[model samples]
Target: MPTEISSPIQGSLVAIVTPMHADGALDLEALKKLIDWHVVSGTAAIVIVGTTGESPTVDVDEHALLIKTTVEHAAGRIKVIAGTGANSTKEAISLAAYAKSVGADASLSVVPYYNKPTQEGLYQHFRAIAEAVDLPVILYNVPGRTVADMATATTLRLAEVPGIVGIKDATGDVARGSDLIRRLRLLEKGSGKRFGIYSGNDDSALALMAMGSDGVISVTANVAPKLMADMCRLALAGDFAGARAVNDTLMPLHFDLFVEANPIPAKWVLARMGRCNAKTRLPMTPLSARFEPVLEAAMRHAALL
Candidate 1:
């Protein structure tokens, strides 16, 4: 277990999309440019190959390359947290170990989707990954996709694991997120084990930060990194009024970005901005043109255009 992992990252961390060429090949040049853009735009961290990055569509070698490329391009300018999770424990461990090998700052292990593991099983799953890798592990509990939730108690237990250092609470239930924050604070009072709590829900990030969450692992940040980072900066600094102002401006963009499924709207927004190609792996598609004007107007209003 590496106690040397710095105080968990704060402010907005973007789950960046993996850029691909028109031929469907990994666009390494575009990928490096995106990584550089995040660093320049004040993104606190960059999570490569996460859900927003279309992790499910990528094979293991591509996954490892994404992490390695991101870390290389970031060049210690920004923290790189790799999405090294899978339903299989062995595969997850291998990915996590690869993340460590490639010098990633941390690993985001999302809950096993489609499998619906019990609380005990969830704990064991995360604990095994933490023990297997020497890097800090942030549990990702997105019930929306996983179809299963890792309870606060389970997260608290995993907090005891030497390498399990934080969680990305995407359940979107602010009360539950607040409860988990309170619980982690109480547990840390005695153990000296600090477990960071980051909201995976872009909508509830401000509220969660108000309740003592460290920051957010944001999907919205992929396009609006500066605004998202500024919001988190304000909230973390106890400037709720300032944060709310930024959040309010971003509200329309946030809501509309999910007009379809995640990456669809997101990639569409990026395409409109000319940032990425807007190409997503199958089972996902481009945002409908009917919604284009709607998102474009929202982006204009948000001043992201």
Candidate 2:
């Protein structure tokens, strides 16, 4: 079995974008540069090939290569959480196993998309993956995209599963997130095992963390890494006032990055900053020109411009 993941994986884990050239080819060189930048910029972890990274568009081989390349490139300087999710269970297992082979620290397995599995189905789906591989798994529940939402009870149930370490709750419902945290704390008191709850929605991250979430799986962190990192640090350290000050600066970016579908705006901003090309695969397009001024103003508000 793979070694157990360490407790308390927390802070600004950037749901990083996969850099692509104008022709939509994977930009491996640019990826390496981004990893180095994250390390220096104090990003707590790198979540590669996630929704923000356009996971659906990449083929299986491309997915494996991205995970492998990121783990290799990070080179122990940062933790790489490979986005090894798939709507298919077997496929998710295969990708997760590949992530394990390539030495990723953990796997962020999203709730199955499109199929709309029942809660029991969701439980078995995630459990099967955890049982099938030794890799530590973090459950991602973003019903907005996945359609199938995992309930807090189901999440608590999965907390009992060994190797299922934490969850990224993207429902953007703070009441739900805070309630889950309360229940998880109760469970920890009884079972002596820790279960981390991370906010997957950037706009509500500060509130969630302040309400006792572990940290954020942030989309905004892709562009504003240092500021995001600092905010998360302050939030986790229980300095909500300081964290709020930083978060206030980032609030505009938190909302605008999702002005289009996830990565479109994120990639555009990265290109503007000269970090990477703004190209994305089909079904996902470049940011619409109409939204540029809106995004640019947000960037300026965040001092990223």
Candidate 3:
């Protein structure tokens, strides 16, 4: 059995946004402040360079620098999970190694994207990464963009690998997520060690936590860290009512934040909050005016202004 972390990463683990200057460069000063804010606000963990960080746009050097800077800025105040996944297996290995070198607590590796690899391919791709690096690996199965979803069986298989820890199940399919939890628990029954399961979808996190998920790799937490952290804490403590109360307050913002592609609305909200400037790479753009009223109303409802 693979040795598990001493405790589950319960509560909000923010898939934090990368702070960018108006010139399209990473704002190290702003990034440090965001980390300090999350730590002070009771965020359980800090996830840097994930989808919300615009990983697709960040070059390898910048990506490594982001992870290193975040880890340094966090200063052991919270866990730092580096987003090191890439469509190319070799690239993933390279990134994972760098994350480990920089003292990342774990590596959140997404399922291979674009190429649409088969299940065997997914297992091999992740297996290669785990084998190549000693860092604890959390599989990221975000099929909405990745196209290829890592199935429960494959995730379980990878969990058997020495350094592969668990997954961020983002299929938005509750049944599949429940089944994966059952399977991992069953593995623990015989092996005496359990793996962690975190939800990738913000909306489904409450439900998944009700079913025993450890926490969520949340994009929503970037702007509303305290509420999201409180929600996850309540859920992990089996206080579903409390979790729901926070979720209900956050529901509108959550829905509106993703009215467009992730990081787009997320960036806009951060800018509006004065946390960071709103800028994105060529492929993604600012939130359209059509969605402005919806987001504004939600923000007002949340009293974020």
Candidate 4:
């Protein structure tokens, strides 16, 4: 009989931004600084080169360099979940292999985007990566960006795949998230193979964790790592009231970070804190002037400023 595989991560995981210079070049120094900050801030892990990190713009070589640098700098202080997802299954496998070789603790592989593969294809795609790489794989489902949602059934099916440890549920559909948890419990009992779900959305993370989610893979954590870490810790510890209290302070950031497409407003706040230069790629424009006050107000509310 196969023993149960408990989740290795559970807490505030920052879907961190890639700090770039004003000229739009990668700032490895700033990246190291952020890693140190997360280690001190009690962040459980970091998902580097994810959506907020502008993975689309970074070429494959840059992707590997970013992951390798993060793993080296992190140096066991915090878990590094490298964003190794790609629309090409072959590319995804290669990236995951590179992550494992570089000592990354895990890989966050988003559902293949634009291709819009079927549910079965999704299973095969993720299962292939799990089989190909020895590193832990966390399935990322954000249909808002991917255009292909991984249904609960597909996730339930993928649960049986070895090396596939957990998922990041960004769908923000609480009812379905609850349903997946309920079903997973039954499945785990039958197979003795366990998996977990982490909320990919910060605003509804409390509600999801209240039901059964392990924690959050958060964009809000980019600026307010301490508060996000505290909230996840409280929620996971069954201190809903305390978590709620902390969340009341962060509620504005949860909504405001997305006010100008993630990492834009998030970078603005980080820059205000003098953490980074707040530069983004070409297609992803700078944070518009009109929304600055809204984000500023959020930063003040969260005490990030």
**Clash counts for the predictions, in order:** 0, 0, 0, 0
Residue 300 in candidate 4, Cα distance off native in Å: 1.2
Please give, for residues 1-305, the per-residue lDDT of candidate 2 as tens digits: 53565686889999999999888889999999999999999998999999998998988888889999999999999999999898899999999999999999999999999999999999999999999999999999999998999999999999989889999999989889889989998998998888878999988888888888889999999999999999999999999999999999999999999889989999999999999999999998778899999999999999987
Alpha carbon lDDT at 27, candidate 3:
91
Number of the top-ranking candidate, with TM-score as the measure: 2
TM-score for candidate 1, please give it: 0.98
Reference-based lDDT, each prediction: 0.89, 0.92, 0.87, 0.90
For model 1, how does the per-residue alpha-carbon lDDT over 1-305 read when each residue is reduced to its tens digit? 45435477899999888887766678878788878888888999999999998999888889989999999988999999999999999999999999999899999999998988999999999988888788889999999999988988888888888988899999989999999999999998999877788999899999999999999999889889899999999999999999999999888877888889888888888877888788887888777889999988889888987
Please give the TM-score that candidate 2 achieves against the real structure.
0.98
Question: Could you tell me every candidate's TM-score relative to the true structure?
Answer: 0.98, 0.98, 0.96, 0.97
Off by over 4 Å in 1: 4-6
Clashes of 2: 0
lDDT of 4 by residue, 54-136 (tens): 99998888899999999999989899999999999999999999998999888999999999999999999998999888888
lDDT tens readout by residue for model 3, 39-141: 9888999988999899999998899999999999888999999999998999999998998888999999999899999999999998898888888888999
Candidate 2, which segments miss by more than 4 Å at Cα? none
